[model samples]
Target: MSYFLSKLVRFNRSSVVGAVGIVSVGSTLLFSDDDTRFRTFVTARLPLPSQDASLLTLAVPNDLFPPHLPSFGQHGILSLSSYRVGPGSSSDISKEASGAVHDGSKPCGCFGRDTIANAAAKVGPAVVNISIPQDFYGVTTGRSIGSGTIIDKDGTILTCAHVVVDFHGSRSSSKGKIEVTLQDGRTFEGKVVNADMHSDIAVVKINSETPLPDAKLGNSSRLRPGDWVIAMGCPLSLQNTVTAGIVSCVDRKSSDLGFSGLPREYLQTDCAINVGNSGGPLVNMDGEIVGVNIMKVLSADGLGFSVPINSVCKIIEHFKKSGRVIRPWLGLRMLDLNEMIIAQLKKKDASFPNVSKGILVPMVTPGSPGDRAGFCPGDVVIQFDGKPVESMKEI
Candidate 1:
């Protein structure tokens, strides 16, 4: 909110009434060197200086490439098939526009308007009920029920490790037998291949008679705010329950919620997720799984969190390679560096280490991993694994 004074015109013979050319952008006032000119701009923006000094107007750029196609038409990404039944066969008018057809009738299979329905169909069958029978002191106790997603046709399930792990028992979830019930009412005995407690991701394998329905994995990095997504799970043990909502956020920090020992970040959505919805697939409109439903705020409504499918994929890769997720942590507190933060840091000490980019390492715990790794307090970490890092959140 500032204004810049450009040219000042003195009145006839140093008169008090002077016409001052003031440039204003917001409510801020800009004055001349002698404090004579002052102006406050509200809604209007000051026009930029023209090449001709005599002119006080603005120049409009010509549209070098104006659009020639119609605004509303068949999009190339979701265009209908043009193939006909035969050479002399009449064109089917009913299925021409895929956006018009409804249920029970011949499905148009439109990707435009019916994305929600299509996503539900693809993800519903892949979502399965994961039951972990808890054993205490060699006795059969109650079982914990959660959800899982079939990520592979050969009965490979993607779920949260917490789902199969009993909170009371010190034993691993893989030691116990897990029962996976598909949406089609087929029950299969699942064996936990590996469970990464750091990321809350688990991989389960089952022997199936035939190929099972699986969900496609989407790029969670492409997800943005307001993107339509469907949460498919068996919430409260209710079968095939689907909730529709928009992606409220993509990278929500787990530390901000005071949640310890969880993945650093999570995908936040407004979709309804209950106790039994954990490990369910958060499906996108393209019938692809973008995230895994993990937790929901009990006190508030519409607050749900999920693990990004991309991160889960990474954990699974680690499981396949090392059979465990290796999370190396450096006990150093850092801040995202910016111009304002640099100025603030310089105020405290003149030699605050001049850094224009990267995260600001403010404190390093003594005898911690960071200290043993030769990390200093005032050092700035510009890259990780040879890749440039700009913010702490992104790192």
Candidate 2:
């Protein structure tokens, strides 16, 4: 290959190119910038006897190192623009001589090709495709597609709660039922066995066909950015699809889509997750499931979110017993102390009214917690259980 062509190939180490070079009766040789195995090619037009069988060696420093191992059993040279070669004409040729394979350096897993394939094969089966019937108006018009991970041999599927939430026109019918589709294309009826809207996690139950393929859940608590990860899901309902990328970010609160009232924490990733990719499993290079894929802003591409698998497990266990996620509540709706409200308070006596700080106790329930806690009109509550107070929105 020409020096210019080889230089272009240097920038793209993963591509293989084909070209021609010339062999001369007088030794004709070439050398790479740093003794790297630039690439292999094929060509004709030898300067020497066509059947000479002489090896044309490229010069390299004995102490220099190459970027990666050259392709084995596939290395060949080609003849380029030379006096003996007809212009714009070339022939196919093969070399019996082998090119040296470069083992670039450690931490470069170029040598771990088989290891990565085997790991993916082992974990791919555990990532499942999920389908839920979405009820719009009074009819079930379509289905919501997402992904899930089988967490038990008896068939307990764990997925994002938002993937299965019923959007009934009225609160009375929000209790509509949900169904789940497995990776094998078998669809089964499932109920919202458990749902934590705050954490956006849900668990579904399907009858065991045999032993279920339970995923090897890993600890997301140990995750960090730039760690290699594989997101396995049915994005757009494509079952067992795998995309590889580095962990873009961890413990991100910015992209959270759960209830605005909750302390939402999430794992942010740049993996290509699209519609129907939600509720999948994000696994580390070790083939361990780390996070539960959850949400993505529609306007943003390449932005995906997942709830830490550790948090999902805890919420699932909590829902298993409590029937609902338990969250602390002060049960008051307060108005903010804006400039106008502050000016009014300043005009009042030294001890401003309850509306100055606490939830403007609009109308308390007759015998509820607010009434029993001495939370009545004209009383400003500056704290809740020793915690500094904010608007009831903080409750």
Candidate 3:
């Protein structure tokens, strides 16, 4: 609920700069001085607060030059100091008395504390914890915990495809049993209706005796970077956990990140999400579902990914009608041009041209549309439908 600014220091050698100020977010620092031969030294340590009050004081050395050299400027040495006075301190009390503090706890006529609390109260009931039982050879192997959002009054739940899929990377059939737990401690048997691996989305249905609470779907296209978002899920088997963060990016390509089995674009956020958080809902400030938590980068922190609600809506409609996604197939086997492939190509034939980027077609199906369109083996597909194609996945 409380946010604090973290300081970061960067060093540059190309320019001679002497100043002290708060660095802006994502700002670049450059130094350039052609006349002076300067050797800069930088040392940084974590700030320590005072015991009585959270007051951070940083002292920088004034004498930066060696004893052999004379002072260059009006001051022989420069000393820079900074202080960070914490909340509730004397400085903050003065600001509060002056009405400079913005009270986030009060309603600001918009998405304030009251609105966020009301949104959570309205949507929390619809977020359910999903437990999937993996059965192999008639015996129970193991189980996986995830999260889902009820999308229909009749108990239709929407979750990630990976949640319903078995450990062996196979979709769960109707016979497979899944347990859905509501916030009220009620449990129901769920059946997988349809799942799409490419889009990483699945729909489950549970025949509830009474009507269930459903979440309102929102437009993901309206989401911009820095927009506030709340993620609700059962992370690490903790039920009904909620975390808040900002939208990190709107359109992150899965292929660009070396991630397969994902749609072309995905939503990225900094929300604290964990393993069991998959298939949960990423709600906007208005309490509308904007995305579905899918995956997080294991090697990085706070790099959570989600499937946009708009894309999921399209997939849900398609699955509802056809029970499966029908994808257009291009009968062509191609490889992305890279350094290794270029090296191999040059070794195979000295006449091979040095191409930086393109999809190299190793073979084209004989009777397919590609062959009919005069495509042949060893042909490079630089573009598709007028868009540049760098990878076969893009095509």
lDDT tens digits, residue span 111-206, model 2: 254333344555665666666554567677556667788788888888765566432211122245455666556666665566554465777777
- TM-score for each predicted model, relative to the true structure: 0.57, 0.60, 0.66
Whole-model Cα lDDT of every candidate shown, in order: 0.60, 0.51, 0.60
Model 3: per-residue Cα lDDT over 132-245, one tens digit each? 765577677656678899989999999976677542344343356688998778899987777665666888888888999898998898787877787887765567677778
Candidate 2, position 81, lDDT: 16
Candidate with top lDDT is: 3
Model 1, 1-395: lDDT tens digits are 00111111211211111111222211221112122233221222212332111000111222110011111232222221111111111122223222322324454456465456555765677789887665567676556778899999999999876676433212233346778898778898987776654456778889988999888898898777767787877655666878888889899875565432223678889887665677888987766899988766533467777889999989888777666655555666555567876675566455555567676555667997767776655566776766677765554
- For TM-score, the strongest prediction is 3
Off by over 4 Å in 3: 1-109, 135-141, 167-175, 260-263, 350-357, 365-367, 382-395
2 or 3: which has the higher TM-score?
A: 3
Candidates, ranked, TM-score = 3, 2, 1
- Which stretch of 10 consecutive residues in model 3 shows the poorest summed lDDT? 1-10
Model 1's alpha-carbon lDDT is 0.60
Taking every candidate in turn, the Cα RMSD to the unseen true structure, in Å, is 22.4, 28.6, 21.9
